[model samples]
Target: MDEGAIEIRQLRFGWKPGECLLSIEAFTVGRGERVFLHGPSGSGKSSLLGLVGGVLLPQAGEVRVLGQAWGELPASRRDRFRGDHIGFLFQQFNLLPYLGLLDNVLLPVRYSRLRRQRCEEAPAIEAKRLLAALGLEGEALLSRPVAELSVGQQQRVAAARALLGRPELVVADEPTSALDEEAREAFLSLLMQRCRDSGAALLFVSHDRRLAEGFDREVALSALTAAPGGVQS
Candidate 1:
């Protein structure tokens, strides 16, 4: 197997003292692999993602992304590392309401000089390519405020943003929950194709098993947690 895109060893985390939300002896996702992380409603799925993304530190053990331990980095460095190496798609499609869609998609490049350097074309050109791939076209649509787009359109914009500059790892948290069945499948197809094209490992967390069929592997977040009572903090 190739080097791990993400690796966790004896990981443990909790929001409050004496309350363990997640415990995982070992978890790994290999380079270019797509893994469906099965996380039901009350599972510590979100917490796991936060740890992997370096938004939350483990109480014990380690999280390594692309072979570097996140805990070793200072907070500012960790944030820059995350911007350069990871792309995130949240369930809520967190777009700046006032920004134009293209500008929103170009945000990562602004923050990470490494990501900007990785772009094959100018940032504007690349943004357009990604948005077009996700089925948003025309200068008019690109120029419109994100607030005016429908939920599905906004979701596509979010996907495009996550995919910009081809970060090494793409982490998505229940990104398809708001879409209808057909829309969900279509979105997944596009997202997966883009990840593969960019050689990015995908860690997609969702409760929907049907979406797990074509993934390289399936992981149950429930099984990873040793804490009792499905404690999610």
Candidate 2:
């Protein structure tokens, strides 16, 4: 059987040693699962994404992705592991202002040999395909600098970048927060469909509870971390 996409146990994390931002006994996101993780602002949603993505490590306990524990890997290896297996959609939609949409989507291939190798076709071909799938088709649009795109279009570009190379896991940090209700729903639909096509598990973080529907499971950060048993698959 395939390993779970994410697994957490007795996890504790905080920027300062004594202050605890998150504490959970167990939490898991299974392979190919679409999990909506919601919580109020300042509830450690982004922090949790950082932990699972290996950008930050818990002070105690395990954060395992694809069955590999984050703490076990050295810093350099951790970076490589995350680059190869996890795709992140930051809240800011961090695209290079100067780079065109296609170039931005190909960024992962530049960083990760594994992801590059995973591309079934040429990297550029795959990037264009993802762009088209995300509703950013046409050379006029694809060739434009992402900086010129509107908020919604840039968000789609970011999603395409995250979905490129078909990483095993994708994490979105309030990706749809800027969109209106209709646009939010549309973006979510496209993002989820791309993840499904790639067989990548999605852990989408948001403060909006109304956006929770259609996910395979919806979990709240407070409940997951505060509950005695924590959340499990």
Candidate 3:
């Protein structure tokens, strides 16, 4: 059988000892699948994404990506592994303010040779192609400082950055929180299309239930996590 893009089995985590933040018996996102994961605030959703991306390790059990256990890798290897295999669209749209849009998108290639090698063309050309695919074409816009772009534009730039080298897995954490309904739908359509074209599995986490349609599967965070009855939101 093919390995899942993400797998969490018998997982337990906590910021403090004996205080469990997340306890999941099992959860998985298959290769090339689009999964919409929804839950209320303070549901350990972002923390779960962190674990999947190898940013955080579970205290017990295992979190694996592409069938490799994250806890088994050293910190440096974990970093390189994540750089090579995982693309993340953070909640805040973490684009550098000092760089232009193209430069911001090219950052991943600088860190991961595998990512750079996966590009069909030179990194710069590929960056422009991704930006263009997201409707940010033209030198005028590509050359502009990323800081000056509007929220929606910046979000697209961030998405372009995450999708740049066709990483196997893309984890988006509340990526459409700021957009209006029309823009959100348009952005999601484009994002899903890009993932499909790249054969990348998408693990999209959001509280907004309206955006759940069109995904291959919809799962609630509450369904996967085993925690106390009430946790602060």
Candidate 4:
């Protein structure tokens, strides 16, 4: 199999009719690589991520994941492709308020049979193992409503959910923003360890430069984006 996990070529995207928010000549992320993507606000980081995750399609050029061109897939197939191969951790955690922690973690399995079949253990058991790995344990915490958990704890839960089915790619968007300095470091350590264990490629985005040190590689979105006047590079 080809080693590249993600590849983009001559990509262009914009929300408004004639205003371009992002333009890139090329970008690639290898399999199992942990990459930190840094960009200031309005640098189109989220738009880039949306393209990578198949939430948005580029107006021109290709966005391919695991060798499949996202533009070639129909809308339903793109959604399935995302569910099957990409795990997402949004800034807000995006957990269901009514579901228990375990159920939240098992959500992917419920939606994607590919994810379900990838697990050797039952989905519930695997969920607990992932939760435990991320420092949430015991029946009490597992059964508690996610809305009641602390910001850091909720972040961990989100990480566990993302890593549950061993997806080939994990995209985390400002996951550490709500954490204190100490907690942020701890959470990142655990998140990296889990991603390594699963051999999942990680794309972590943040404005904080301090957290960029331990990543295998880093890319600044500003360098890749082309605004109205010219390309920043």
RMSD, model 2, all Cα superposed?
A: 3.3
Candidate 2's TM-score: 0.95
Residue pairs clashing, model 3: none
lDDT of each: 0.90, 0.87, 0.89, 0.88
Give TM per candidate: 0.97, 0.95, 0.97, 0.96
Q: Write the residue-wise lDDT of candidate 1 on 1-233 in tens digits.
A: 35699999998888976677888999999999999999888788878888999999999999999998999999999999999999999887579977888888999998999989988999899989988988999988877888989878888899888889989999999898999998899999999999999999999999988899889999998777777785773
Candidate 1 displacement at residue 18 in angstroms: 3.0
After aligning candidate 1 to the native by TM-score, how far in Å is the CA of 68 from where it should be? 1.1
Q: Which consecutive 10 residues in model 4 have the weakest lDDT in total?
A: 224-233
Question: C-alpha displacement of 222 in model 4, angstroms?
Answer: 1.0
Tell me which of candidates 2 and 4 scores higher on TM-score. Answer: 4
Write candidate 2's Cα lDDT for 100-181 as tens digits.
7888889998989999999999999998898889998998988887878888888888888888888999999888888888
Q: Across residues 1-233, which tens digit of lDDT does each residue of candidate 4 receive?
A: 78478999999888766657788888888999999998866667778888999989988889999999999999999999999999999887569898888888999998899999988799889889988999999998877889999999999999998998899999999999989999999999999999999999999999898899889999888776665643221
> What lDDT score is found at residue 157 in candidate 3?
88
Clashes of each: 0, 0, 0, 0
**What 10-residue stretch in candidate 3 is worst by lDDT?**
224-233
